[model samples]
Target: MVGRLRARANASMWVAPALILVLVFIYYPIIENVRLSFFSWSAFSPEPRPVGLDNYRALGSDPVFWRALGNNIGYAVVSLVFQVGLALVLAAVLEAYVGRRLRGLLRTIYFIPAVISITVAGMLFQFLYDPHIGLVNRFLGAVGLDSLQHSWLGDQDTAIWSVIAMSQWQSIGYTTMLFMVAIQRIPAELYESAHVDGAGRIRSFFVITVPMVREMTTLLVVVTISGAFLAFNEVMVMTGGGPANSSQVLGTWLYHSAFLNDDMGYAAAIATVIFVITLAASVIQLIRAQRRRVET
Candidate 1:
């Protein structure tokens, strides 16, 4: 009993640092933000004043907030389509069609952008989307589509989409790599059995590959959704939520309100909303994963 107790005590000591860090950095900020949401605070002011639900009430009438929320939803949808969907397709094609020798090279090429910092990617895209000197407009003109070339980042209609495209470029390869890893783990005998059953590549892929990678697909979906909501640095470096706030997401809007508009209370409310949404998504994902584990 004494030896067992001492061993468990040593294990507890090893975990204590991580537990303390999580409490201080993660839990404390969440609690503080929640408390701050019910008050009126400005950076210039000496202290926050309790306003109960006034900040949240103001959110209901805030058109900018609504626009930002819409943009965030749009971003999540786009991320799902391009990041998760495209990555799955790419991984499938590579695993099924591409030769083993070429696959590694191709994967490295695709995954390069994922390693590049988002700030660098944002800056690079800014140059690419530049109205006068951008490669995008240049390519359009080269293809004799001059009439179609508008300011990519400056136009409200195209600004958010441009950001989405950049995000896809930066992330799709990472998603593809994840899916590829999962796909590679699937039993090769399953593919052989399908082939002996006279299944074509396309049919085998649908029947054998897709179902096997369900857990990876679920993980990517949750990650992509959370990333879409938490996106900030890219927007900050790219649009600054501009072209008249058309590209604003909840993250950038919160920054704008807190620092620029000096409305920390409203910003806290926005943060709380974002937290609830992401937390709910995480909880749902956890529950679904647990159910899957139980069934399996």
Candidate 2:
């Protein structure tokens, strides 16, 4: 009884701060946000009117909302392909080819963008993409590719891509690091055995590395799905939903409606939908991962 009591006390002590923080910050805010999503209010209006399904109904018919939703999907897909895919490939190279010191040094260099704040990244991007005197345009001009040096962030067709590149620059390092860890943890014996049996690097990678890292890949996919669905910061900074709402995403649109337009109820409805979609994606990903795990 004495030992049991002491253990319990230790566990309680260890968990105390985390429990308090979760209750105060995380759970509390989540509950409040869900509550606020169902009501209508603005800056001057202190009271929120309960407009059950009207906000949702309005979003269904909103063209800007749909455009933003499409843009968010595009952002997520492109990010997944370029960001996570390239990260995986680079991580493989670093693990298989580079020495420890060199790999770590390269990783640190790549992670510099991620370590900086998003606001700073956005500001830096704005300058990099400046039409008249930007580095990208100057490089294009110098290379005799002047036709491609038009306004990047300012134009509707290219704004989202610019934001995506910015996101990729920031996030690729972390994802690459994730892949590298998973790859490094893989048993060396498997590769050694494969080498003796006539399997080349390409074949071994396909047979061993790819199958081994399925779980990490699945998790990254889930993260990408959630991040894309709830995208906000990049869109806000890079384009602010833009020259004509071309680069608008759900989060930015929600912000515009709730804060800028003072339509809290509508924003809440959008929030609720975003929450639902993200939850659905999580559930679907888990199910798929588990099925693959079982099958393998």
Candidate 3:
């Protein structure tokens, strides 16, 4: 009995620090945000005034909020396509098509962008997109395609896409690396057997590689979706959700509501919505994966 007690105590001691941090940083803040969402307050307010669901109701009518949500959805779609889908293709090409001698060098080159700091990447893109004396515009002029050049970050029509492009460039390599690891873990014997059966590379990829990497693909999808919803830094640095709020996504909108607009209650409501969305997406993906595992 004493030995069991000592073991339990040691386990508790090992876990308590992490548990305390989660409660303080994650759980407590989530609960408090929910509570705050029920009230109205500004940073200068003496006390938060209970307003029930007024903040939510306002969100329903707020065009800016709708625009932000739409932009986030756009981000999610683009991330799934460029970050996840492109990564999968690149991984397949590297693992299957590339020669052994060049694969390592190519992987390092591809992953270099992922290692760059987001702030620096954003700033770099900002410089690249500048209309006057910027590389992009200069290149367009050199190619005799001057009509395609504009203030990439200043125009409302192009700003959000510009931000999304930067995000994809920075993140695609990380996703590709993950997919490459998944591909490597797949049994080489499967491909060998497929080759014996006269399966071409394309057919083998669809029949063997696709099915084998299903779980990793789903994981990357979930992560990309979550990241899309939480995206702030690129948007903030590149456009400041600017050109008249055309590039505002949920994260930046939330920040604007709290700090710039001083509407703490509304910001909390926005945060709650984002948490619910990300949580729901993650839960759905996990449940689907679990179901697939059971079936297979």
Worst 10 residues of 2 by lDDT: 29-38
* Candidate with more favorable, higher TM-score: 2 or 3: 3
What C-alpha lDDT values do all the predictions have? 0.94, 0.88, 0.94
* 1-296: candidate 2 lDDT, tens digit per residue: 99999999999999999999999997887677678776777778878888777777788899999999998889888878866788888888888889989988998998788788998998899999999988999999999999898999889899988988898888988888889899989999999999999999889888999888889998998898899888899889889999799899999999999889988778877887888898899899999999987886
Worst 10 residues of 1 by lDDT: 281-290
Clashes of each: 0, 0, 0
Name the Cα RMSD for model 1.
Answer: 1.3
RMSD, candidate 3, Å: 1.3
TM-score of each: 0.96, 0.90, 0.97
Q: Model 3's lDDT to the true fold?
A: 0.94
- Over the stretch 1-296, how does candidate 3's per-residue lDDT look in tens digits? 99999999999999999999999999999999999999999989999999999999999998889999999999999999988888898999999889987998888988999999899999999999999978999999999999999999999999999999999988998899899999999999999999999999999989998889999998998999999999999999898999899999999999999999999999999999999999999999999999999999
In the predicted model 3, the residue pairs found to clash are none
**lDDT tens digits by residue: candidate 1, 140-251:** 9999999989899999999988998999999999999999999999999999999999999989888988889988988888999999999899998999999899999999
Off by over 4 Å in 2: 1-24, 27-32
Off by over 4 Å in 3: none
- Let me know the TM-score candidate 2 reaches against the reference structure: 0.90
